[model samples]
Target: MTDTAVAAPTVREVVAALDARYPRSWAEQWDRVGPVLGDFDLPVETVLCVVDCVPETVEEAVAAGAGLIVAHHPLLLKGVSSVAPDTYKGRIVHRLIKADVALYVAHTNADVASPGVSDALAARLDLVMLRPLVPAAAGSPAEGEGRGAGRVGELAAPMRLADLATFAAGRLPATAAGVRAAGDPDRLIRTLAVCGGAGDSFLRDATAVGADAYLCADLRHHPASEHLAAGGPALLDVAHWASERPWLDEVAGWLRAQFGVTALVSDLDTDPWTVHAVSSNKENHL
Candidate 1:
């Protein structure tokens, strides 16, 4: 008997390819990465990529005719006490099975990959060559290998804090709310530090590295105020979903190039919260 090339890579092969590129061990200890369901022997035709796996994204995958969904955030985090159809996460699981869609998450492993989440964010603003914000700990799974999180880079041309904020807003996906800045808007900024998700924890590191400004999401009132008061890097807060969404295309592109399989991006806005619409009274009908 002789072995023949598989018609299409099985789910197991796809998983193996991803693991080789971004080892599961590289994921933060608390993160859940890898296949959540579906058998390894199953054949995968089309894969959809998204920043988060929410109901909307699930629907998008189905509508896009995808058999697999590769998301940056894990849908099943923490031990699931129960997966009954009544629960929210349970419903998501049910939808996947009903739609015959497989779910795989990359989480922190993708975050730490070179040219990953933060790198995509930095590219959006056209930031030049730079270094990592919190260099991956030495001896760690992806460490000493030039893979890390966030980034600190120089701008193409020096611009004021306000101008940078405006520039970022224009480049990134638009949301009901635009970008917001902290510190003197007119303050000149040439060097920038950026992380995709919540990044308050890296304030000291950004400061120590002498970044002129830092861009990320989920900056609390106190932390943003205190960082500026302490003369830390100027801050720019954006929608967490928006900040990380740019990487989905990169991920899908890589999967397509490496695996030669169809890859799609889920356009569904998966962020849980929706901005409220406030209407002016002048529009009231007669």
Candidate 2:
């Protein structure tokens, strides 16, 4: 009997495909996206998908013998003086290089891709008629593909503001900061807007798009309160990590189906908040 070898995609090929799907040009001018570190010619057999490329996730990839890691967030978005391997980020870089693992980031580019971050989030809530909350500007790769920063859509059925918050809480990955909402709980919701991470910037866009309720993460005090005061849509805030984790599955599935690779999502929770305590005073405190 003759033996047949299964061919694997090279690091260059995988990064190319990712860039094609979520072009770097579509990302914000100040943002970093695309391949970060790796041997371009190395054959990639197994891939690990994660929301963040921290030390823990790097260890997970090394332990799994993953040739490549696709992360939603950048490992070194801010400028660093060096990769001395003693510092946290530096250690991650050295670890991956030693393990022969490559790291790629998809930040804002993935957020604006057609089946982007918020699309996965909306899928959890069973939203329909999905469209860009903030459509891309002219000449970008994602410009005319119904691709943009955040997403807006209609729910399968109308529900009260309270019910929608509860439903969203049940749908997203569990985090210490489970979920919180602001506005009249009894208000009805049919249209919804969602952004996967740190999406407070899109509050006005959600309102302009006529979303009855908006779901996202990292909602600060003044903007949230001012938006509500101005009669904006209802707001639902989830954990930053929880909001973006769903996209890992999407990318993992795509990698498997598209290239016949072994793609796995890391189960580690990267959200900073671990313990959430409820205030004893409840409504009386306010």
Candidate 3:
């Protein structure tokens, strides 16, 4: 008896599948995404999906025998003079190249995808009747009924900011920083706005759309303060890692179904802020 091996999808075919779901044209002009490394003709039998393509995740991919790493963040955001093994990103590039593992990114393109980042977050928060906070341009790649940068939606019933924050902490992936809020704990919230990653940029849009609160990650102090000063929507901040982690499973499932690839979501916590220490002395010096 002869054993027959299953055929593997090439790097080009896997990337095509990803581009079909999150078209590269949907990415913002400033953003860099898509295939960053690897030969297009390389056969890919195993795929690893992750929010960030860090060294640990790279090692995890290598250990898992994954031929491709579908990362949410682009490894090279800016032009690099070299891919020398000494530099961090360079090291990553060299490692992937050495392992013959392909690296592909789907950043803002995935953000505006139909069942995109904000959509996944909204689902986690049990949001209903969702709509895009910033609607994609008509006839654009991401143009759809509920496709855009952020999402605005409603809960089953209005709740206090504290309650909502608690719900978010429980619902989101556990992380060191956990979930933090920057508004009245008792403030009533009904309509919610959410962007999976850093979302301070959308404060005005959330306010203009009449959202009661905005849930996102990487909220800066100045922006959060200014938004609250302007009486904009209340803020709920979470770990950047937790916010985008939800979409990994969805992407993996889609890849598995579409191309019969063995796709896995890396559960490693790649968020930079590891230990968050709270000061016992509450007196403000400033």
Candidate 4:
């Protein structure tokens, strides 16, 4: 008796699975999703999932012999006339091609997937009864029970606003910007809203839903202050990378189950902020 060999899937086959899971039509009009570069016919044995398609992740994928890199953020989001090696994004693109590593990006489309980025983040916090913070359009391709922009849910039990922030800091991946919260520290939080990436865009939506607190990344100072001043839910801002990194593991497990391939997550911290120091004005700890 002999055991059957595990089969590696071609780039096209894997791309089809990714697109089906996170439909390209769900992506924002200005966003890019799907395969960025790769030989569709080439077989991919290992896939590296990352939050960003930067030099560090590309290097990690190459060193690990990853045939394909599934990136949450697009390497080339804006228009560019040249991909000369001297340019930043160009260098990364060049490295991937040289090392025979194909690249795919699932940005906003992945965000809106039924069990997408925010779902992972919400899970990290042990939230329950999750629903979309911003539901998809009624007739859009993304329209469905689980398809939406962000997530709203209730913690297993209530905690103080400050404790909730600390709990989140501990739950999410470590980063220079761990977690920052703005609101009444002693306030009890139950219902919470979360968006994996930048979420200032949904502050009003969170408030509308009567969520006690909202957690996400990249909460700009102005928007955050105004939201709180307007009596919106408390805010917790984590590192942009830390917030979305959870989805990498979620998707990695998914790929393994769906395609039976070696899908790994890159732990490289690509959040840009390497050092963090708190104010000496008071004894502050997170």
Once fitted onto the true fold, the runs of candidate 4 whose alpha carbons sit more than 4 angstroms away are 1-3, 281-286
For candidate 3, the 10 contiguous residues with the lowest summed lDDT are 139-148
Instruction: Give a tens-digit lDDT track for model 2, residues 166-285.
Output: 999899999889999999999999999999999999999989998898999999999999999999999999999999999999999999998999999997999999999987765664
Residue 35's lDDT within candidate 1 is 88
Give candidate 3's error at residue 137 in angstroms.
2.5
Residue 76 in candidate 3 has what lDDT?
94
Tens-place lDDT digits, model 4, residues 102-130 = 99999999999989999999999999999
Clashes of each: 0, 0, 0, 0
Model 2 residue 125 lDDT score = 93
RMSD each, Å: 4.6, 1.5, 1.8, 2.7
Alpha-carbon lDDT of model 3 = 0.93
> Worst ten-residue run, lDDT, model 1?
267-276
Candidate 2 residue pairs in backbone clash: none
In candidate 2, position 180 carries an lDDT of 97
TM-score of each: 0.92, 0.96, 0.95, 0.96
Pairs of residues clashing in candidate 1: none
Residue 183, candidate 2: Cα error in Å is 0.7
